[model samples]
Target: MDPVVLAAGSALVSAMATDGWQQTRAAVVEWWRRRRPDRADGVGSDLEAVRAQVLAAREQGDEDTEQALAGAWRLRLQQLINEDPALADELRRLLDEHVDPALSDGEQPQHRPIIMKAEARDNSRVYQAGRDQHITGS
Candidate 1:
């Protein structure tokens, strides 16, 4: 998948979970209106339906369902980009201008880097993770 499509899909799902979702949803539908006027209404309705599902999934702590919803939107976006290619720019703009801002308004996760150093006389072991990691030692 295109990086922009991936980012936009994730942002779209994240925005749907925010209080600013209505505005973000409107922008998305309007973008679809310009690109595929005939399908705009259906697209809007589908977005709303998906948003409802996402909300319910979050309430139930169903990460799998939320991720599945994101994947669906990613596929939809991938199809759009495959058809027009130029829509990739529009998706990036939507993510940068609207979706990302809405997500920022909500609680943003904090990430911190990890640094580790280890030394031993007989042996040495070191484990480091800048992000998520798993390690086993013997």
Candidate 2:
């Protein structure tokens, strides 16, 4: 499978689980709008249906179902790209510009970030913790 198709498919399903999914949905439909204009409307409707399934799966704690949905989309995108290899670039652009941002917004949680960096030389040890660290028998 094309990496771009994999990424776009993953992003498409991930975005469907987010509040900003409508934006990604629009971007996807628009992709069809440009190349397969006749299918654009149906694509949008299909995405909506997928979104509903995703939400329900999430609510039911059905990770497998969600993953299955992602897989289905991956195949769909691969088919699209198969028909027009040129679409790979466009799909990459859409994932970067539209889908990723929507994922970030939708997955935001009420938690602070934890950053840790370590550089060890000459058998030196570096330890960092965001919350707590306990070392014994050093």
Q: Which candidate is the best by lDDT?
A: 1
Q: How high is each candidate's TM-score? A: 0.76, 0.74
Residue 84 CA error for candidate 2 (Å)? 0.8
Evaluate all candidate structures by whole-model CA lDDT and list the values in order: 0.83, 0.82
Q: Give the per-residue lDDT of model 1 (tens digit) for 52-113.
A: 99999999999899889989999999999999999888877777777787886443323212
Determine which window of 10 residues in candidate 1 has minimal summed lDDT: 105-114
Off by over 4 Å in 1: 105-138
Error of 2 at 100 (Å): 0.7
**How many residue pairs clash (N, CA or C atoms closer than 3 angstroms) in each of the candidate models, in the order given?**
0, 0
TM-score of 2: 0.74
How many clashing residue pairs, candidate 1?
0
RMSD of each: 6.3, 5.8
lDDT of 1: 0.83
